[model samples]
Target chain A: MNLVQISLATGFLLILLGLYGALTNRDILRMIVSFTIADTGVNVVLVAVGYLPGREAPILDTIPVAEAASRITDPVPQALVLTAIVIGLGVTALMLAYAYRLFRARGSLDISEFTELKW
Target chain B: MNFTTRKAIPLVLLLLLGSVFYALFAGYTPDETLNRSASYYASQTVQDTGAQNVVTAIIVTYRGLDTLGEVTVLFLTAAIVGLVLAHSKAPKGRSGSGFLPSGELLTTGTRMLVPVILLFGAYVFLNGHLTPGGGFQGGAIVASAMLLMLLSDSAERFSHRLISRIESSAGLTYVILGLLGMLFAGGFLDNRILPLGSFGSILSAGAIPLIYALIGLKVGAEFSSILTSLEATEDSQ
Candidate 1:
């Protein structure tokens, strides 16, 4: 009914799709992409939690006179989100690079075939 | 097959376990009410740092140590990329062919967007002290611009030597500035060396913008070099 509930529903659906893709897809690259999608869904939920109705950015100049950032989106959440984005990017890049190498070495993108690592 | 299910189960279980762990243990908030907006650090960063951006506040001030670690990671990645690319021997004294994928619009669009991206990236880095963008974000943007150039105009080549030099020197400068901060200023990585000019000015931020600039150049060069090496490897193969 409310905006948060709608966003929560969408995010939950996205998480389910990501989980399905990560499971059903055989390609390692697709699995990684699915992982990213799931990560993004979680981030969306975190950001939604910070949303405050009718509150401006917490910057002093942006806030109205005598009216503080009541129920405004939390800056802490925003900052945390930014850091999470960076870490996600780093991890994604690393995964892709490794996937590329795996494809080159094994001539296949499927994770099921990567049993050479097991002793 | 059974093998596929086995592989899927580990990854699925890992993700589930990690989420459960996070839900259980990661609920600690700061004992102090450290609101990121309109806080002491923000004021200090604006007044004393001369940075036009507050995101630069957290980047260059409150979480500066984290920034240092990030740069170190970038530096390490660049080094490893260089090592990997170098080991794959092709031919000496040549950067090999620069064959771009066809369709003129991509190249044209790249040429058009490259400057805009560079300009915006510069703006982001310069205004990081007062705005939402900071060194890392802007630096990545600049790198993206370089990647665009690589992708669009395959003929536009970047030199490995130049790339290596930029990466090393910029990283070196970051550490040295940090040391200088420790020796002379309040502590390590302090922006107390340069005169914090009038707030909101380009020249403001004790040395914040300069640091961001170094980071931008370093990231741009490092990433471009990595892309270049990959292209070359693909060509050779």
Candidate 2:
């Protein structure tokens, strides 16, 4: 299909792959990586959804200001994705910090090892 | 549960989810035009904010409060990482014992690249209103300099006090600027507190460049703090 559709498919496939990896992987670090993959997939989907058939980026540097609405793809999604990417990075860092602490405490990186919450 | 079932269950679930995604992909149709808010930003960015980049205008002006919250979240993440890793830190005297010295090439490359990276980051944030880059991207770039330094010299110790001071001061100034906007301009975080200036120049877009510069500093400091804290734990290993 079109570029947008291809990107959308790729995004969906990435999400699926990530989810599958997270579910199958027992290592905490692997799970974290899987989650990041899924996070990236979500971001891709968002950007793809914002894409127009044939439009310039939402910057007015090249395109005239008056024609922006018709000329540019939806900028809202790009802005939202920017925020998402940053937040995702913070979350990943926090997760890694927690994982390091966990590894230090228990000397294990396996997800099944930490079962404090399990009933 | 059994190992086979553990794997099988996820496979089954993903199969179902994949079908759902397939349906969504099939049904999805691209929009023909900008939605209301998108159009509003596309049109209003010139007269209202005088920023060449509509995304910067929206982030630094229209949605400033959200950006403030986002920065707070990063701060909290950095703080928590430091807190979490504090007890595991290596003693000060034994900092560089274990790791082999990084080669001369990496050391020299870092030395050569770091200042340029820092300057580029500053440039990106400073001209955010007129270009594609902004505070977050610039801040991340600045943090990458710290990353490079750490890689070259694993034992490189950063002054936490200095980093925290920069971070807190930038954050405080950002808030004060927001309040200044409320007092002087239309509302909180209004870029119009100063003149919007001539469009497309570095000085245009009122306080966006200034606010973004502050954001870049704060974000860079926070990311560097996080990186430093993580690096500190390396010596304990």
Q: Provide a comma-separated list of chain B TM-scores, one per candidate.
A: 0.74, 0.93
Model 2 DockQ reads: 0.89
> lDDT scores for all predictions?
0.66, 0.90
Clashing pairs in 1: B49-B205, B50-B204, B50-B205, B52-B130, B53-B129, B53-B130, B53-B131, B54-B129, B54-B130, B54-B131
lDDT of 2 by residue, B1-237 (tens): 887997799999999999999999999999999999999999988999999988888899999999999999999999999999888676664443245667899889988999999999999999889989999999999999888877776325556798899999999999999999999999999999999888899888899999999999999999998888877675344
Instruction: Give the i-RMS of model 2 in Å.
Output: 0.8
Per-model DockQ against the true two-chain complex: 0.22, 0.89
Which tens-of-lDDT digit does each residue in B1-237 have in candidate 1? 577887778678757855763453245232233365544543454455655444555667656787778767766665565555554544544334355354689878876888899899888877666566766678788878877766664434555677778888988898889899888888788887888877566677787888877777776666666566555554235
Docking category of candidate 1:
incorrect
Which numbered prediction scores highest in DockQ against the true structure? Answer: 2
In order of appearance, the predictions have TM-scores of 0.76, 0.96
lDDT of 1 at B20: 63
Top candidate when judged by lDDT against the true structure: 2
Model 2 CA deviation exceeding 4 Å by range? B93-99, B154-157, B234-237
Which residues of candidate 1, in runs, are more than 4 Å off?
A: A1-16, A49-53, A58-73, B1-52, B81-113, B153-156, B235-237
